[model samples]
Target: MKTLKRLIILTTLLSLLSISLPASTLKASPPHKNVILLIMDGTNSDILTLSRWYRGTDLQLDEILVGGVRTYSDQSAITDSAAAGSAMATGVKTKADYISMNPDGHPVLTVLEGAKLSGYKTGIVSTSPVQHATPAAFTSHTLSRDEFGDIGEQQVYQGLDVVLGGGAAWLKPQVKDHTKDDDGMLKTKQFSREDGENLVTEIGASGYDLILNRDELLRKGKSSKLWGVFAAEDISYELDRKALKPAEPSLSEMTHAAIARLSQGEKGFFLMVEGSKVDWAAHKNDPVGMISEVLSFDDAVGEVLDFARKDGNTMVVAVTDHGNSGLTLGNQGTNENYKSLPAEKFIEPLKKAKLTVKGATSQLKKDRSNLKEVVSSYGLGNLSSGEYRTMKDAKSMDDLESEMVKLMSKRANLGFTTNGHTGEDVFLYAYGPGRPSGLIENTDIPLVISEYMGFSLKTGKFADWYVNGEKFYRDMGFLVEIEGRTSNNPVMVAKKEDEVLRFPENKNFYWRNDEKVGLKSVNLYDGDTFYVHVEE
Candidate 1:
């Protein structure tokens, strides 16, 4: 009780102090009409150097080089994408696997959400599942990143103007004999709901143009809202996307389409574009795949920069959430001749490969007898005797791919220290109006973006919009109780007289007695407490 009193006193004093400050002391929102935040997931700073060398030309990202951003979470030094992305989205550091939630497990408004509330069109585009960690942080709030169905559903009701990516499977109910692994075992999948809710149908019914393929996206009719889900899981990597079934679009294509649609609004827009597979390739320690993904992301950056330059009122900021795969130019093999080695030694070897390690691995049979023949067709041949034996004896497909990546990386004289995320500062780039420069914390992202969006997270608006559910309801003469405290789908029930309201966690709707009520926002709970949004 004493601690709570002190906190209340501190808040009151701060509010009084703010009220006493001069008008100039409070920085006004910038005059920018739009803001675009592009995240190249799991990209290391060194990857830029390698990609530039591979392309033999300067990337569009080179023109906007600003400084760097420190990437760390509230709990761990080496942060995962969910926590890292949430820090950038909400301007607060959080625990791993948390999407737009604070360390105390309460919902915090994201920059995109705030932009929407401020009357700006908002959108999110990514190469991975839109419900994947990085994109999910900007679009939804959840305690666990693994809550794909919940995240997918929340995005549909968040009132965004545009959303394009993969993970179509999560929106539909599971089908028998959907897909199988090499062992003929049914792979685990997460579909819409345990009770079978079809969110894709709901999206169309909610007035969004539901697109399924590249042709549909290109020839899309004029619509106020657009939602495209390209694949069952993540869309294919850039190197392997050419042969992908259903003909998915490139990352740049998605970015271009999103920008075109989002900019039509008179009030401006906020869009987040993510090259999500760069991290996936780095986790495999495949330099060729990583380079391919980076180049694709750079192309998307080109599209963003082009739009920002032409508009002149848009603020463009691009940065990676975190670093991965400690990739270095010279490996142990080049220690003695590192300085003497030409750029061709690194660039030429990677150029020979036409497919990513994933694409090559997909061509191999169960027996693995055609490892050499299959890899040779992909321009990754000449494996040493020991390399052949190791790959042949690999226990699983994952093990085989790892070995293949190591051998290919060795041949290119490239080095990778680990297959996991690294704790490092990532390069930050920006262009046009209201671009932040110098070294900044990842949490500073939303604060910077909010400055251009005509809102302030530091003001009383945040506390008023998202309130402590139990206290707020109790103050209104209602009794509150929580159900499913241990399950992913938790609900907070409030009762007063004959009025009863049920708020489900991580969803955009609630129940009043027997009637279903849809909300423009989600109700958040961090295990112990519930945070509800108050409509203005």
Candidate 2:
């Protein structure tokens, strides 16, 4: 409440958005267009504030704190990521393991599917495997989120405009290695799906451009349908990802690319971007890792906000599915009379961990590996005998990582009650058109988006207006023209060579002649050369 109170008091926080059209204007049934929903899975208000404070970066999401949302699952108050995300995606309560379905196991349409059906382009991006619960709920449906193979099948067959994330193992082929110890270290790993279809290959065969690394992502064709998978499973946690694999794009980069591709269409778009590993880090109770992940997620939120600020019609929703591990700043500090303490000291020791707990634990499974040396690298050499055994003999990666994180928590003076989600409501923020107001139920999420579309646009019509190089102002009324070629001009938007421009005002016509005269643009890429005049 302290941090939230600060946010409420700060005038700058609420200044991110102008007031929406008056209540009277909304009665006209004016259609709302683009929407971007960003979920930081398994996060709570504690992580949000600490990340903003420790990282020292000005996250734009902090300036738009709208309210909080209750996160109870259909069957229980203690909601897992799958159920919480499903509630948001489908506007219905669901069982703990379900994805995009009602509690009765019936397939419920998601806002993404609604957008697709209504002719709006759809996309999803995540730091975890795309088949993971958070991202899965938006575009795929199943009684269980564990159905990774099934989820991957729909990810391709559904033919979204853009899909980017890790979790390539679900869609691609893999061979098992039995030679290694079977202590559940995934030593014998295989990923070829049971259906025998390699969706990664099929994605390219189906005319979608498949990208595997950061460079390819940035250089991907704007006109090409895109499917980019950065890692085999979860993208490495932010703490060690860049240092270990520089080629993989960050969360913000993926968000930017997904928007770039999806926004190519005139019908508008619905995109869900998840900073998924925040929950994983939280589940392990690794405050340092959690902070970095939160900051990373917030960076992506900043990207979406940047786009929304420029494109007046877009709405941005930022929320966390639930809280995790019951993290607090410090037990030594209390209300009102709390002593000022050194947050940097705690944050600095976390810097010693070069790899995520999961990554470091995997490195220790080798024959000559010294657990002491491995733990020491993360400032955890003081583990007790029982704690040491718990770490060394961890039955699964989750156990191994959680045990290691517990050890690290002691040194940092941070306390964690459990290794799973807590029942607490989490922070939810919004800005721009169709923003959710006040405190809301988690199930109200999809409805907020659904209602914003106002009515389904069968033809995906947008009132696109062209500017003839003079001054133009954008309100929340329509889709306006993009950039000219002038470097200093704010009106100049980057144009791709193979772009197919849609002019909805002219019977939603597809304009594709770049070098042809009388067209709005040409191959020479000169904004002034080809100008379309307005007839009044």
Candidate 3:
């Protein structure tokens, strides 16, 4: 009887020890430290291959591919912005058309929210409207991705640390200019609909310093938050925007600015930067435009890579949601001049002339002999007289685009299908800590990030949990004490009941709101717990 009782006690003690030890103590080290997700919307794999061929050397992306992974989702092959971005933001795959909402229209938790709960600062930057699909997925949970107005409103309430890029008009109320419309219907229509307060004003009121231009963004400031808007809609493409605003910051500039601001947090941060126009150019089946956009996006990638290399712990990922316009390399042409034309020459003259295909063709006929010279210069010498006549009558941009395709096809061996998305799988590149050693699917993105951040998925629901330090625990449920040290030194304690507590300089921690009384030291203790109270 005595032996049996002793055995039972031993078993109970062993069980308690197992419960107290962390699961990681028996496992391998966790992967990455910080993660930076870069979305290149509507970019296709062919663009990378073509770019390599055109440059006559391998690109930096080729090196990244060696350490990266590529995998598709179980969702629709040709995914829309909302669906694709949501899948990348969250681990689970949902049906097409849902943004951050679940299949049943219920709101789903995103990695951004998860990171915030984990005590990390969060930010989003994009060339598109800050409320646009890709950025929206990380921050807002909306049933309809088309709810731009709602998304814009949610951005303000979320208290995100940083927001940059265009879409200013979406945040401000729409003002109807009756005189500009040249019609009286403006008076009868509901003209003064409130689209919520100006995003700049709301963000300012929420504690961010508003910076409208590049200079302010680069200038050092003490504010913990930042909001910048450069245009009313999506910022113009790199080539076009530079011609318009020489001082306007490029995508790389915006990315660097975001990182600089968010990295202030002691617990680390999560940021999303997007190059959105790659899809727009692909949608038009404009090879020059698409290639230019891809290269511009690559420059931004270089910026992030540089930062990650210095930080050592920052994980950087570059990927596209889906392919567009089924671009293909076609049969070789006989015209030597066609093969000799520089890639820029084919597109620059057309843009410079500002002559629509119909207008250019019409103007060409007025000077009939000049038509051959102009067309031949573009390497479209094979264009028939009938084709020129048809082009002359073209009435709209679409018609001109069609004629331009035909003419360019004769000179350059290239082919494109309908000007829309395709079902092809896009490429993904990842570097830095926490990434697996092999290729991974799109679903693996959220999982890898969550794991690296030390957060676990509970029934695929991450809405309520937060991560702190190397552990992902539930959010502070009822105001428990929080404490941290800067240099991992032994925590100091008060020597006397009336003596002031002194904290070491440069330590980082947060205390309860009510315990923020005057302090002799930076550190203060409430009852048995030491904390450093900080403003949210």
Top lDDT hit: 1
Badly placed stretches (over 4 Å) of model 1 are 1-32, 175-192, 384-386, 483-490, 509-518, 526-528
Which window of ten consecutive residues has the lowest lDDT sum in model 1?
A: 175-184
Clash-forming residue pairs, model 2: 174-192, 483-492, 483-493, 484-492
Instruction: Kindly list the per-residue Cα lDDT of model 2 for residues 446-475, writing each as its tens digit.
Output: 888877875431222211212332222123
lDDT of 1 by residue, 165-187 (tens): 99887787773324435532446
lDDT (tens digit, per residue) of candidate 3 on 114-160:
78767788899898888788898888766667766657766766677
Could you tally the backbone clashes for each prediction? 0, 4, 7
TM-score of 2: 0.73
Model 3 residue 510 CA deviation (Å) reads 24
lDDT of 3: 0.64
Clashing pairs in 1: none
